[model samples]
Target: MKFLDQAKVYIKAGNGGPGCVSFRREKYIEFGGPDGGDGGKGGDVYAEAVEGLNTLIDYRYQQHIKAKAGVHGMGRDRTGAGGADAVIKVPAGTQIIDAETEEELADLTEIGQRVLLARGGNGGFGNTHFKSSTNQAPRHANPGQTGEERTLILRLKLIADAGLVGLPNAGKSTFLSAVSKARPKIGDYPFTTIHPGLGVVHVDGREFILADIPGLIEGAHEGAGLGDTFLGHIERCRVLLHLVDGTSEEPLEAYNTVRGELEAYENGLAEKPEIIALSKCDSLDEELEDLQAEPIERATGKDVARISAISGKGMIPLLRQIADAIEADKAAERGKDARPEPAWQP
Candidate 1:
């Protein structure tokens, strides 16, 4: 199936059932009394985050979802049956928004998280309620209230600990394959990866998920070079593993190009915790590798990691560095949680 991270859809809740009016009589009875029953409530529509769904392609084709309507009420005080609720399974990390207003509705970050999109309509009153003390016989009934409807937007963000970013053929795929069991397609040409790929890096009894986003180029923010659509996949990443081709004509230029695109696309994306690396180090010698690190590190104001995805050199150290960054981010969040909130002043 094709990967779709964004989708727009319309959802509707079930309508309530109508009330029933009837009269009961016996062979010897002279008069009959009103015996109307109330209708059942309508069904609600909800979206749930479930595992095994990694894409929003299903929502692309089916844009409209509606729940079943409740059954009508019966006579002799027999209430109608309620409508069955509808549940749509969505991928984890899906964010629901109001499509028309662009307002955020819900952020489904964990598995099995559910959000009610539309509420069911209320049931109507029965004719028996209209029978009052003033009138001996009365007949009246109320219609069921309508259900709620809303247009929604569903966006999927990749929830990974570390994200891999680079220009095409920067050995990102190779690095992921070497580190984890994920086998993404690899090629020697540009744009080898058309979609985002995921892998888990396990080192020293510690494991973390790594995502390989498609290569980005200059002018990516202005809809150039595959645009910035895929950038959302890495927005929630705790740390970024920047891969620059070590053998490129100008390693620093390659580094700057990808870095420039990141800053242009998302505000503060460039400021995120990042671990820079000179990929494809097998083609370079020890002297060149040592010399190459200084300028890259000095220019970016960050240390540069060296690795040869094919030869497996520097893989362990690189993985350890990423793990360390992940742990530190977690620690910082914990520290924030430990801090107590200030008391409100009168």
Candidate 2:
């Protein structure tokens, strides 16, 4: 299936049923009073996050979603039936935003999460409600109110524990394929992976999700070479795996270019814990690999791991490091959640 992360849609709630107006008639009765029943309520519109979905491509063709209208009122004090509700099912991590104001309405990150999009109009009153001592024979009935309608924007962001970043042909896809079962397209050219791909990585009896997005080029934040549009997929990652092509003429420059793009992008992506690695080290000897990694290590003041996805060199250590980082992050999050609340002051 083609991956679609964003879509625009219009939703409308159902209209309420109208009230009924009727007069009672009985044999041998001198006078009969009004006996009209109140109308039924309308159906609401809701958006729900469901499992087994990873894209918003289903909403591409269906732009408009509408609920069923309520049935009209009947005579003899009979009320109309309520309308059927409309439910929109979306993938987990889908965010609903108001198209006009660009304000976020709801962020669905878990399965079975639901949010109300529009409320149906209320049912109108019947003539019986107006019956009083002042007005003995009230003949008027109110009409049903109109339902609510609005346009919405749905954006999907992939949820992963770790993400891969680097320049084109830096071996991000190869690493993902080697580590997990995800079969992303691998090519020697730039932008081999157009869309973001996710995989489950298992290391030492531990498993975590991994995401790989398109490679970033110089000025990627400003619409350069595939742009930074795909960067949002990794915004939720706790750690980043940055791969620098060992065969490149200047690995430091390549690393700096990707770092610059990440810093330029929003959401504290640059501040995330990062693990740097020199990829395709199988093509280089030990001395040459060390020589290529020296500048990057010095620039970042961190030891760079030499890895080759094809030959599986340094793969275990790299996976172990990623697992450890993810575990640490998870522990930190649990600590934050477990913190005691401050005592209330009088």
Candidate 3:
């Protein structure tokens, strides 16, 4: 299926049923009073996040969504039936926003998360509600209120534990395919991956999702070479795996170019924990590998691993490092959540 991350839709809630205006007419009773029944409520509109879906492509075809109107009231003091509700099923990690006002409505990060988009109008009062001692007989009934309508925007951001980022032809896709079952398109050209792809990596009996987005080049934040549009897919990742091509003429320059784009794109992505690796190490001998990684290691002041996705060199160690980083991030998140809220100051 084609991946679509953003969509705009118009939705309208159901209208309430009109109240009934009727009086009881009995053969035995001489005086008949107003016996009008109240109208039923209208249906509501809700947006729910469900699993097994990762794209908003379905919303592209259907732009308008509306709920059913409530049944009209009868003349024999019978209440109208309520309208059927309208539920919109969206993928997890979809954020709902008001199109006109540019206000955020809901952010569905987990499966089964639901939020009410629009509330149905209230049912009108019946003639019996207006019956009082001052007014012996009521002849009129209120009309049903109108339903609410609004335009909404849905933006999807994929959730992953680790993100793969590098310059084009840096072997990011090769590493993902070697580590996980995801088989993304592979070629010898730049921008081979036009979109983002996801893979589930299992390391040491532990599983975590990994995302591979389109490669970034220098000035990517300024609309150069894929324009850093796919970077949002990895915003939720806890760690980043930066791959520098060992065969490239200047590996450190390539690494610095991608790093510059990440820092320019903002959203704390630049500060995320990163593990640098020299990819396609099998193509180079020990001397070449050391020569290519020496500059990057010295510039970054960190140890860079030598890996070859085709030959499965250094794959296990890389996966273990990613897993450890993921676990550490999870532990930190748990600690933050477990901390008491400032002890409830008086």
Which structure among the candidates has the greatest TM-score? 2
Clashing pairs in 1: none
Off by over 4 Å in 1: 343-346
At residue 196, candidate 2 shows an lDDT of: 97
lDDT of 2 at 325: 93
Ranking by TM-score: 2, 1, 3
- Give the winner by lDDT: 2 or 3: 2
Error of 3 at 85 (Å): 1.5
lDDT of 2 by residue, 51-90 (tens): 8999999999999999876766666667778888999999
User: What lDDT score is found at residue 8 in candidate 1?
Assistant: 90
For each predicted model, how many residue pairs clash, with residues at least 3 apart or on different chains?
A: 0, 0, 0
Error of 3 at 293 (Å): 0.9
Model 3 agreement with the true structure over 71-171: per-residue lDDT tens digits: 66666677788888898899888889999999999999999999999988777777888889998679878777778999999998899999999999999
For residue 268, model 1's alpha carbon misses the true position, in angstroms, by: 3.3
TM-score of candidate 2 relative to the true fold = 0.96
What is the full ranking by lDDT, best candidate first? 2, 3, 1
TM-score of each: 0.96, 0.96, 0.96
lDDT of 1 by residue, 1-346 (tens): 7888889999889888888776665678677677777778889999999999889999888999888777777778777788788887898889999988999989999998998888888777777777777754557666676788899999999889999998888998999999999999988988889889889889999999999888888887888767778888888889999998988878888888998898888656787898999988899998999777778888978888888988988889999999999999999999999999999999
Q: Candidate 3: misplaced stretches above 4 Å?
A: 341-346
